[model samples]
Target: MAKAFRTVLGERLRRLGKSIWWRHCTAAAFLVASLFVLPARALDNMSFVVRGGEDELTESFRAASLLVQSWNDGLTDPQTLFAAARADYGRLVGAAYAEGFYSVVVRIEIDGREAATIEPLDAPAAMREIRVTIEPGPRFTFATARMRPYAPGTQLPPAYGDTKPAFSTAIVDAAEAGVDGWRNVGHAKARVADQSITADHSADTIDSLILLEPGPRVRFGQMTISGAERMRPERIARIAGFPTGETFDPEELDTVANRLRRTGAFRSVALQEAETLGFGDTLDVDLVVAEEALRRFGVGAELSSTEGLNLSGYWLHRNLFGGAERLRVDGAIDRIGGQGDTLGYELGARIERPATPVTDASAFVEARVGREELADITLDKIELSFGLTRVLSDTLSAEAGISYIHTRAEDVTGSFEFDMVALPVSLTWERRDNPIDARKGFYLQADVTPFYGFNMTDSGAQFKADARAYRSFGAEDRLTLAGRVQLGTVVGTSLAATSPDFLFFSGGGGTVRGQPYQSLTVPLVRPSGVTVQTGGLSFAGMSGELRAGITEKIGAVAFYDAGFVSDDAIFGGNSDWHAGAGLGLRYDTGFGPIRLDVGLPVSGTTDDGVQIYVGIGQAF
Candidate 1:
């Protein structure tokens, strides 16, 4: 296309040179063409040459080509595209003039195809190599993070501000919160203020300013509750922990709302901020609630490698007899290998009370009848339990319960009936759910069950005590070192002992780090001439395991365990110890660590065994 235009211009120039009228017409044509070819406004700042020498012109054309390519690829809107091209070309043309290029023209091609040509009418623009200089800029950090109206009161430790302390409880404890950040001042508010960091060759440090805003010291406002009555409005409100005139908090409001929701007592709850009091910026809370079905039902099915397939269903009355109470009836059918199949049923009721905004208490009672198969024994048992549980703190809790169980077992050898009754009490304390580094967090739990015959048979008074603790050494989730040890003993006229059969065995994912299930069991085969009374249970065992996280998702563990089972310390050498080590992979699912661990026995006599266990929540 350029060659054709050049040919036409050459002929026209020749004809114009021969006649004055033609010369005038040729000049006018040149001006019109110049409008199309003149460097776009963008050429002003760019460096280029229209005509100087081969080197200069080549560089200019190259630069223009690159500029055009960028424009075509980046600019989507036509107006913007044209504007950008004009500005760029205009800069380049101006730069070339400064650099002494008398004549220059820029041609644009896209995808190896020509698109447009631009140039100055009287001069050419050429761009050579460009020199770019970049210099370091000063970095900035938070100068101060502070709160308004000054944090209330003063008993708070200075550490709270110095360390940028966050609430030990859930952030929902804040005054007012929405999806992302603070919306309104609820009951209590906290924040980081005067936060600043300093870095230098000698040291680096973070300085923080923290604030707590516990909105206006106002008493509770009139609680306005709304929702279809599943029970009674007053009853639901009380269950929500909002007993009228209680000092109001946005956090408490949310907690109450959520608890009611999880009960399935409401379809939706809208807790609104309304009617404020001037004394201290307090508001009368108006909760707009929507009730769901008072009575509901659901069915579920599950398949497992060990338990096979099972179906279960439940019918629920969320607001049984009004108040914050619930009742349900459920049933299930499960099959066992070679033990035939059995059906089971149960009815249970639970009552929940929001004793406080941050605390909850509940009581539950359940009775169940089911058949279980263990080896040659086919047993049918009826069990009943009553329990009361309360949230001691966010990461700690305790519960106590009483249970009665009756079992009748039948085998080809014979049929026997047995009953076991016991009192169970347990306490669990966890700093972090599961730590990748075992040495950083602390998890301690202890449970004891002392029992007396609800019947006779092989029954005897027994006492079992178990405790485990772990600490994380690195980040909370990454465990660096951890250990667990447990022991159980029975004492009485004819009490139950920790037999090779009855001992609390510890070897698997949650126990001695490297042994398989029941590997810790003493072999039944005994040496000749050694008449051992295998019938009698014996001393309990102690297991200790150390685990270290290698990464956020991987860890190595080493462990040791020792135990003995004898009628009454028959042999001083009866106790034996086993040790092993292995590695594990952990996936953080927020809920807890999903662990996959593989281990090998280091001391015990056992086959090459691999244990694979998968379940929800944390192993500890």
Candidate 2:
């Protein structure tokens, strides 16, 4: 009985193995067939060809047509290809018209049949070829052009009303220029009322008659506020400095929007003129604002070969007291590498009130404590300060402040402690196109501070000025030349009697890169026959950079910096000058550029060789 059972089991196992082999063969055959048939069924291979035009015009038309771009990539469906080609006819015609080809003709054919004559339902199941032919007819020129009712003193462009090419874009641009001419002279409601244009096919000429309505010069009406959620509406108006009851000027509205945006209180701010004129020839203004979040925080980091890694962070409250008052706390630590005891740290807090007592004026209070260890000195300090800032104009401002400081400092000379009070004043004038990546304009900053020390029985005055200019050239202003000059001086006290932080020392990333930080100083010889560096009482520095954009997101920079530090209030023959040259790479981000700079000292001590610095924004 056992032998009979074994024979039956063997027969069943044989049948099972045969069944599995058959199924495997079927699957392999099916996969092989799909490899050949799948792609042909899924993809619609179409070729697009453009003919009958100059190379520049043909390329422009092709670039403007979505159909060409799609066909170049091989569309996957016949319906999508047909739709794109049908829409491209209008786009191509418009492109020709923009170039003054008013009588141009565009023809599209699919598989030897005109696309326009074929119905969608009758289209071939698959499109194999498409051809576009363009006949850009003789260009038309303006023969007679006239615009009426412009306000007095309106200055239109010279090209306006001239026998120039009758390009569609040119006509639209002229109309806009006419409206702007009136708007510049307080006609806030100026607009194009009507336009009559006639094309003469025989002569290939166009005649244009544009009518403008320069409504009566108006004054500014009361401003209405909208879209204020967390911020008070009254405060927004006050901060905007609405020019109510004055002649309407577009520039004033721009200024108001800029001021509100600079406060960081709003995400979006728009100043719009009312749709209808208000009473007594006045134009009512509306301020539409979107407030940002009330609280924010950020962190930043930097690296330098000489200064090591530095990290900083800040916390801010935008609407601390519901009046666009800002409160911020910030902290930073530097020098992670084993660069002696040169580690440094700082913590500070500040509160600011915008539109404090008057429009365009602000008040702030700040307190800080910090410790620094440099090659020449180590300092621990605490300070309290309060200040008032006034904005005289869009590009000018002034500030005055009072501060008290207590510091304990140690140097090669010895350890000393002092208490000092300072009255500081400063003025700033800036007209740069951009604050972070300035392409054109000038900036000037001047500061004067008088300090009195109680513990050291010393009194002195310090003055400093920093001036920078930026100019751009090349296509699209892709190249920027920026130059900076800085000068500082101290009087009424010797360097030893003044606070160490108040004195000047050259050679650092901020002064003369590639050299050690605070490395250039006045030599002081002690009785022990050892010479040590002491901070200088006077300083001057100059820097220049040529920044060129290589692409939309990448740029290159070459820079040179030179600095001088002197023991006397003015430059003396013994003053030491340090200079550095460097190349930098920049990657532009939405906020600014990320910068990496490598510098080498050209005429100074550089024991560390080449120094590299990385940070955000330009060094200045």
lDDT of each: 0.45, 0.79
The list of candidate 1 runs beyond 4 A from truth reads 1-216, 226-232, 246-275, 278-283, 288-359, 370-379, 409-416, 434-440, 457-483, 493-503, 506-516, 519-581, 584-596, 605-618
lDDT for position 172 in model 2: 63
Model 2, residue 341: what's the lDDT? Answer: 73
RMSD (CA, angstroms), candidate 1:
17.3
Query: lDDT tens digits, residues 1-620, model 1?
Result: 22333333234222311121111223343345445543333322223233334565345444644354544464333223333443443344333322322132333222222222322232122222222111111211223222333433323333233323222111112211221132233332233222222222122212223233333444456667766565577666655666445554456666767656755677888776564574454456677877777888877543322334456788887777666466777766653221234433333444433332333666777677766443234557677888777666567777777888776765554455666676777888877444443344566666666555544444443444444556555455454445455555444423222212223334444455455433343322233433222222334545554566666655555545544333332222244455556555566555455655555666766324544444333345
Q: Give the best candidate by lDDT.
A: 2
**So what's the TM-score on candidate 2?**
0.83
Candidate 1 contains a number of clashing pairs equal to: 60
State how far residue 131 of model 1 sits from its true place (Å). 14
What TM-score does candidate 1 get on C-alpha atoms?
0.52
Candidate 2 Cα misplacement greater than 4 A, ranges: 1-54, 72-76, 119-125, 392-395, 417-420, 431-443, 452-460, 468-483, 524-532, 544-559, 582-594
